[model samples]
Target: MATPPDWDRNATWGGSNGGAGGSRTPLRQAFSSLSKSSGKKTAQSLSASGSTTPAHPASRSQSPAPEQGDGKPTVASDAGLADDLDNKAKLSLSRQSSVSNKSGAGSAAGRDAGAATAPKGDGEEDTPLQRALKNPYHRPLPGHPGNLTTSQAEALLELTQLLLKDGALHDPEKEPPSYQETQLLRFLRARSFNVEAARTMYLKSEAWKKEFELDRLCEEFIFEEEEAVAACGWRMYFHKVDKLGRPIFIQDLSNLDTTKLLQTTTPERIIKKFAVTLELAVRHRYEACTLSSGRWVDDNMMVVNVEGLGLSTFWTMKDQLQQLLGVLDQNFPELSGRVQIIGAPFMFSAIWSLLKGWLPAATVEKVDIAGSGYLPLILKYVRKEDWPKHLGGECCCSGATATGSDGATPAKGKSDGCLHSDEGPWDKDLVVGASPRPS
Candidate 1:
């Protein structure tokens, strides 16, 4: 793997960011970068990119008003937060800690509902993502030092031994007979390295995958309403990479016509679309990126544009949105590098109030909201060449015409436009058994 990028050695979760270093536990440090204040126009420096260390806004003395009844969001409190420099270190995985739902923030309920409600497979055609899931494969995780501190390395050793002894690491009937370190570490980090908790979560997630036949969904299911959904201005697709080589997932609600979307597709299909995309990311995008970037690229960066989203529209889709969040929190833990929400409109605060409640506390921390002047802020993490022209970048995947001198040519198959192109390094010939691209 390529050498991990350089980050400031001194900027830890507590020191340069906020909170008392020693007194702060993993949970506290996870929330350390979150400012109590909201509705501010200024950009929050929440980038976990290895290339920069810009100043972040100070945390307010008074805790910000909770988006829900209690201030806590619904996800697990493991140190999977984006801004914490040493996120792995902040994982206070001690067995005695009060952090609940180590399997996931709201996974128990989700799992139960899934088991009861999930449709049994009828031997439909399988999808590529599903096939990939069933086949045994191992790939390096995010090739970065952030995954392992000296203590984390030791903790990893301990966790591995415990899982091994428990006979939880291998399951020939349900899963492959072996596992990868990267895979194990992903769960351990999510549960703050609590051996028993990580083991339980791992087992439960595997069961959930089997019960839901997630692999089959990924392999066979295709959104018949994909074109219609895009025509309705609900954009969700992989575009490019950030400065640190993480793939960028662009979700534009600026032109979303919620009514048309509802008329065209059902809530169940929307959720399925999202799940397929996520599984693809894990099976294809993440692996391709890891191979191309010469670094383990496990997570992706999100860019959400909510310029025209209004309170009414938000309220109309609130249920669907919460269901999506629940799916993410329950199934895919710690898979985001950062979730940058840009082009926030006047009613965004109200929207945020409703939205934060559905998000996990760890995920809420990874989110960085910007009302305006977001182009420059977003550029800090995503370079102009990789970004789309609509987002104020040089690349014009719409085939209009390339304008920048950065040599970022319009991606092929421009007829589909940028959102539909699904363009990124993963498309290059370097992913599958080829040599790593030059970093």
Candidate 2:
């Protein structure tokens, strides 16, 4: 809840470090796991972290290539390509224009099967990036102006009236309840300023809130096993505010012992705990931050440490991750500030290549993947003093995986004071003595 550090204003989605005004939607899309451009395939994706690629070629394949037709890469003869182009060009101009129309892009009636598969985003003015940010809860939505532009507000009000007429909201003052301007905007933004979509989404979320008794959950849901989970290398801890007053959530998935995790808990139980934590964070921590700092704080900054991950870990954790991220994406849209994946192993590319299609494009764009050399980038959002010592900082979180020792989790016990990041400076930036993000 402390005032956001001045460095917060420097958070930029575009390429420029600190103070950039553009959104890197184009670049992010270009690097999407589905995108096979050589530039994206290379280690260049890690360049944003300010790390240099090793001189010796360390990567095998940049990404997983698609299954080929008949075990051979399809060969397109130059002559055949030229003929196809000529035939297309010879068509009537009107015919070509009609083919170009977005509505007809996927229609096989008049276009070649290959042609019909043209990029899906061509006619849409909003990029995948823009759509993802429509309901932004982060720093003024990267480049877009004030949260929920005036026009968006009007659209949301229209939705309210529709719901009112439908009797979905019976009492203007009591029933269906009133929400903050920003909260109302969040629903509208999540649905891309579309009134009906927002209406439906808002109604469903309201129903979910009531059905789950979220109020009571927030009051009573005790994460009794949090410390136990932390000891298993599956830490989900919220330490302190970022430069922007958004809470920092650290989840270490890199060093997990899958066998131990399975024995300790089932996938469903683990997911339930995560959902409860996220709900509490969104509903409580966010409000507390906004109240204390007198600034809107709904989104959170995520630091995913994927160090020491291997195929075994991926197979074990895939379902859990898919479920967690899926809920966060569709149900809790626009709640991500800056998502950084540090210490990513080469093996991660395989999983991502397969998983990218399943994730929302906007969410995919927000992830910044880096090799072990992500410390500098992490410091951009959190001061070095507050960083975990295992990752090259002064603070030594009590439960961090043993560096020199094997990946076995340390014993369960109360952490040393430094492991709790809440103790970190709040009145001002902790520029000197380091503080641990919570254990």
Candidate 3:
């Protein structure tokens, strides 16, 4: 066969051959050569002057490219390429070192830049213990409830000791009089001497002395005045009542308009009622039960049967009654029930006033003789003649005599006796006409 133009005559088949027509190399060798030549041509075309461009020094040192033949490129062994990369790296490092040494300022600038970009410290100046102490809401220590340090505890103890000393040394005599006591004394001093202009006599007296006498007399006559005043004060407030003829609401002096009620015609009447009620309560302990059983069994069942309703007891009852009135007003206004009572002076006066103004005459008349102990004393003073009629005279059988079966008159002498005379029609004056005719 004729030899191809591209074929080499002296090419080695599997070894070196003399310049003569020889057997061709292996197919793999031929293909490899061809590829190398092709790669070389491509690389030349891509380069500026039809030559291969040099790679970056670091990259070239790390990995070298394969060699190229006239017609193709050859693949380099991995080991050989690695060695070349190592040599190129050394050269680059040497260059960098030389540059850094020549300009120390450049290296310093780089370091500064790195530092600027790095994270800063948090700038916390307090230590762990200081931070804990400065915390506003720190918890107590393990053994201490208040967590007070020794210095703080000592300071508190000193303050407590000072307070104790002050308290222990405090005395009323050393201090100035209180504002209230001063005012009271001033008022008493001012009212000490009053011109009575009674008949034709003018009297000068200390106000406190007169007040003391008046207060003592009031206690003696009114009986429970002190207790009542202490418990209920001078003024009162009434809240409500039910239809059962019982006080459903009551208050005392503090709640009422003392200036208006005490000065007006109200107080005297209330006092009378209080006195009468107190007397009746004292006298009719067993009688109350009898009356309660006879005519008022059903109604009187709820009535308090204590021996006496003292000022304190009355005040408490009044308060409860007032509360009851309030409840009635809220829950049952249709009953149109009301709370009424005599506070300091007389309960009967309050009842009479209310009856005269708010109720019918018949109701007032009926109320006069209701015989509720508190009312009768006030009725005697207000409507003496009407009192007997309404109250069915003194006795249920014989209505003539002012004396009871025990010969106890109503009010002939002192407070213990009746106020009326005990002389009856049978007890006539001694007749002297027959004696004068015999002489």
Estimated TM-score for each candidate: 0.59, 0.56, 0.15
- Tens-place lDDT per residue, model 3, 1-439, is 1111322222222211111233333322321222122333311222212112223232234222222332122222222322332345455335434433443323321121111121111342211111111222121111111222233223333332443453421222221112112112112212221112210111121232243242233334332333233233232211111122111112233233333333343444454333332222211211121111110101110111122224443443454334433332222111111122332343434434432544322122222222235444333222233222212223212223344445533233211111111111101111111000101
Query: What does candidate 3 score on TM?
Result: 0.15
Which digits, one per residue and each the tens of the lDDT, describe model 2 over residues 1-439?
Answer: 1111221211112222111343332211221211122223221221112111111112222222222332211121222322332344334333433433543443221112112022343453222112211211121331111223334435655766787676555332211121123344555555556778767876776666566555454445555555566567676666665555466777777687877777777776665566566755543455334322223355677888888878777787777778766665555665665688888898989877866776666557667799988987776666566665655666655444344443223334434333454432122121111122442
Task: Sort the candidates on lDDT, descending order.
Answer: 1, 2, 3
- In candidate 2, position 415 carries an lDDT of 49
Better of 1 and 2 by TM-score: 1
Per-residue lDDT of 239 in model 2: 63
Q: Is 1 or 3 the stronger prediction by lDDT?
A: 1
lDDT of 1 by residue, 121-186 (tens): 233322111111121111112212222333344555666677777665643222211113446666
Whole-model lDDT values for every prediction: 0.51, 0.46, 0.24
Q: Model 1: runs farther than 4 Å from truth?
A: 1-146, 161-179, 398-416, 427-439
